[model samples]
Target: MTSQAADRPEQVASRRSKLTREREQEFFDAVLDQIRECGYDAVTMDGVAASTRCSKSTLYRQWKTKPQFVAAALRSNRCPRFAGIDTGSLAEDLREAARAAGGTSDKDQGLLQALGHAVMQDRELQQALREALVDPEINALRDILRRGVERGEVPADHPALEYIPAQMYGVLRARPVIEGEYADSDYLVRFVEAAVLPVLGLT
Candidate 1:
C-alpha cells in the first residue's frame, strides 16, 4: 500500500471517531442536568450513560474519568454571556451585564453550589469551571471598565474597578445565603442601579 492509501484509512477512522455537535451537546446537557439534580459525588459515567441511553464504554472512551467527563461537559456548555456588551456608558454596560448574569443565575448558581466541594478538590475541575463560567464574565467586565476609563467616565486609578467582578459575582452566590433568594434579573438590575453604580460614582 502506498502512503496516500495508508493515510486514507486513518483519516476515515478519525472522522468516524468524532461525535456530531448535536449529539455531543445532548451528552453535555444530560451530564450537567444530572449534576444539578444529583450532587457531583452522586453523578457517574454509568448514570449519564443510562440517562442518555448510550453504552458506558462510549462515555469512558470519550473521557477517561468522571472529573474529565464533567469538565468536558462544563466546557461544552460554555458561552461568553457577557461578551459584546458595549452600551456607550459603563453604568448601562454593567446593568446589562447584571441582567445577563441574573438571567441564568439560578441554574448556574445551583450548578456551582453542586460542584463546589468537588471543584475545590480537583484543580482541573476548578479551572474548567472558571473557564466555562467565571473567566468570560470577568474578562467582559474588565473590558467594560477599560472602556469607561477610555471615555473618562471613571479614572484608571479607581480602586473600585479591581473589585467589580467580585462584587458582581459575589452577590449572585451570596443572595441565596443571605436573603434566601436567587438574584434574578430584576434583582440584579436593581442591585446595579442601587449598590454598584453608586460605588463607582455613576448614575
Candidate 2:
C-alpha cells in the first residue's frame, strides 16, 4: 500500500492560500538578503518570517525546510549575466560578457560566499546554485564559441573551448579570495583580451 506521507501533495494547497506571486518573491528576497548578511547557518525560519512579516508556518508549509527554502530563493533570484548577447565579433562578444559578469554587485558576491560552505554539504543547494549561477552563463559562453567557429574565427575542435568557461569563472571568483579585489569590468576585459583571445588565436 502507498504510504499517506508518500502520497501527500508537494505543498499544502490550503495552507498556501495566503501567498501571491509578488508576495512569494518578497519572501524569497527577504530570505536571500538575510542569508547574505548573516550567512546560511545563522539564518532562522523565525527571522525570515519576522523580516518578511509572514508567519513562520507559511514558510514551513511552502518549503518544508530551511535548505529547500534557500535553494528556491537562489533559483528564483538568478539574474542571468548572459542573454541575447551577439556582437558579430567573438572578441567583442567576450568583452561584453566580461563586462557584464564583472559588474556583479557586492551583495551578490556576498550571498555566493555565504552559501559556499553549505552548498558543499547539501546536494540540493549545490544543484540550485549551479542551475542559478553556472548553467546559463556556460550555455551563453558556449554559444559565443560556437558562433566563432561558424564564422571561421576559431577551430571547431579547439581544445581551449572546453575550458574557457572554467577559466573565466574561476578567475572571477578566485581574484577576490587571492587578492581581496573583485574582478571589475576593466580587469576582466583586459584578462579576456590578453589571456583568452590570445589562446584562441583571435588576438
> Could you say which candidate leads in lDDT?
1
Stretches of candidate 2 off by over 4 Å are 1-18
Worst 10 residues of 1 by lDDT: 8-17
Model 2 lDDT at residue 94: 94
Query: After aligning candidate 2 to the native by TM-score, how far in Å is the CA of 157 from where it should be?
Result: 2.0
What CA RMSD would you report for each candidate? Answer: 3.5, 4.6
For candidate 2, report its TM-score.
0.90
Highest TM-score scorer = 1
Query: How well is each residue in 98-122 modelled by candidate 1, as lDDT tens digits?
Result: 9899899999999998997999999
Off by over 4 Å in 1: 1-16
What TM-score would each prediction reach against the true structure?
0.91, 0.90
Give the Cα-based TM-score of candidate 1 against the true structure.
Answer: 0.91
Clashing pairs in 2: none
Query: Clashing pairs in model 1?
Result: none
| lDDT of model number 1 | 0.91
Going through the candidates in the order shown, the clash numbers are 0, 0
